[model samples]
Each structure stands twice: as C-alpha cells, then as structure tokens.
Target: MENDPQAQEEILEELVMALKAGGQSFILGILLTSILWGIATAQIWHYYRVYRDDSKSLKRFVFLLLLFNLAQFITIIYGAYYWLITCRLPGNYPKVLDVTK
Candidate 1:
C-alpha cells in the first residue's frame, strides 16, 4: 500500500516530539549525575589532602572514607541512569499534534 504523505508527516512529527522529550530527560540525568560525582570526588580529595601527612591511622581512615564516598557516587549514577531509561521512553505521543485528519 502507498503511504499517504499526510500520514507520514504526522508520524514524523510524533517521532520528533518523542525524541526531543527523551533527549531532554537524558541530558538532565547526565547533568545531575555529573554534579553528584564532582561533589563526591571533591570531598574525597579534600579529606585526602588534609590527612596526607597525618598519622598512619588517620590516613587509613581517610582512605576508607574516600572509598565510601566513591560507593555512594556509583549508587547515584546507577539510579540516575535507571530513571532516565524508565521516564524518557520515546513512546509518549505528544498531544500538541493534531492527528484528527
């Protein structure tokens, strides 16, 4: 069957809208993940610098703390990706398009 030009145009518009929404959601997730990762890394680095020349026991504690922060950062990244995948699915047909033809 020959595809009607009007129907093709409507489908294209729907796809474009879905893609734009999904892209926006993905970008938001990336931004949030990056911020959290930066904060965690900075905190760990600060602690390490402060304890670099301290007693051996204190240095060990600082290392452990850094590891904990890294773990938390990983968890945050995983959650962000999960949310993006679930919320940004491209099947959301935009209501703005007039499909009543």
Candidate 2:
C-alpha cells in the first residue's frame, strides 16, 4: 500500500483538510484577540487622559491589568504558532496524546 498512488493521494488530502480545519480556528482566535486588545488599549488611554488626577495606586493597578492582558495575548500567539506551524511539521506529531511532554 505504501506505493499505491490513489491511497497516498487520499491520505494527503485528508491531512490537508485536518490541517486547514485546525489552523483556521487558531487564526480566528488570534484575530479576535487582536481586536479586543486594541479596544482595551484605547480604553486605557482614555482613562488616563480623562482622569489625570487619579490616585497612584489606581493607576498602578490599571497598568498591571494591562500588562497581564498583554501577557495573555502573547501566550495565545505563541501557542497557536507552536501548534499550527511547529507541531504540523513532518514527524512532529506527538505519540498517543503525549503532547505536553
């Protein structure tokens, strides 16, 4: 079966479909995250501009929240890239659900 052209073609097509379906969700998530991040940035900017006399503690808290959001966004991008590009490489698939290792 290894040398059968038709079987190989079908297998290749299935693999392509699986990759497309999996990668599409990742792309959509990244896009949505980018939009939300932009909105958050704008809101934070407005907060600082409109409330210039806010307490230092409050400002620090808001800044920390923004940093955390940025971190989450960064991790999402890295995870998607790792799964879609790195794991999809030839021979990179994990064995029997041992993906975390």
Candidate 3:
C-alpha cells in the first residue's frame, strides 16, 4: 500500500486548508498553536533563568517569538497530519480478510 501514505498526506493537507477556512477546526488549530507558543516561551524563560549571568547567551523576545512561531507551525502541521489520518473516511478503514478456505 505505497499509495496509502501519499493519500494520508493529501488528506492532511486538505484538512489544514479546510480548517483554515473557518469554524471549529480553525479554532482548534489556533488553540493548539497558542499552547505550543506558550510552552516555547516558557522554555525560553527557563533558559534565561539558568543563564542569567551569561549576557552573550541571553535571548531576545523577538527571537524567542520567532522560534516559538516556527515550533507552532511544525506542531500544527504534525497535528493536522495525524488528525486527518485517524479521522479517515469509513470506506478507507481496513477490511479483514478471511484466510480459511
């Protein structure tokens, strides 16, 4: 089933586009991204806390935001991919084969 992975990827891409269109899916994406952003920000905070004396290693808010957004983007893509894969069409489900003859 070489095509299965491609089909799943396509479904995920479509799900992302459709979700971006509006409603609950869009809201869910926003919430998930925001949560990721928050977590990334906290990580930055922790790093700063441990390296407060290292001026050269200090992180700027803008840079942290950029990193956080990048992480959020990746998280959203992965979430969409798996969500679509698991929420497949009923007909797409695997059918059991009878081996006994």
Highest lDDT model number: 2
lDDT of 1 by residue, 7-59 (tens): 65676676567557656766786687678778867886787777577788877
Model 3: lDDT equals 0.58
Task: Give the candidates in order of lDDT, highest first.
Answer: 2, 1, 3
List of clashing residue pairs for candidate 2: none
In candidate 1, what residue range of length 10 has the lowest lDDT sum?
A: 92-101
| Model 2, C-alpha of 20: deviation from truth (Å) | 1.7
Measured with C-alpha atoms, the lDDT of residue 16 in candidate 1 is 65
Judged by whole-model lDDT over C-alpha atoms, candidate 1 comes out at: 0.63
Ordered list by TM-score, greatest first: 2, 1, 3
Q: Any idea how many clashes model 3 has?
A: 0
- lDDT per residue (tens digit) for residues 1-101 in model 2: 25677865655565566667678899999999999999999999999999999999999999999999999999999999888777666454332124332
- What local lDDT score does residue 55 receive in model 1, on the 0 to 100 scale? 83
- lDDT of every predicted structure (CA atoms): 0.63, 0.80, 0.58
Clashes of each: 0, 0, 0
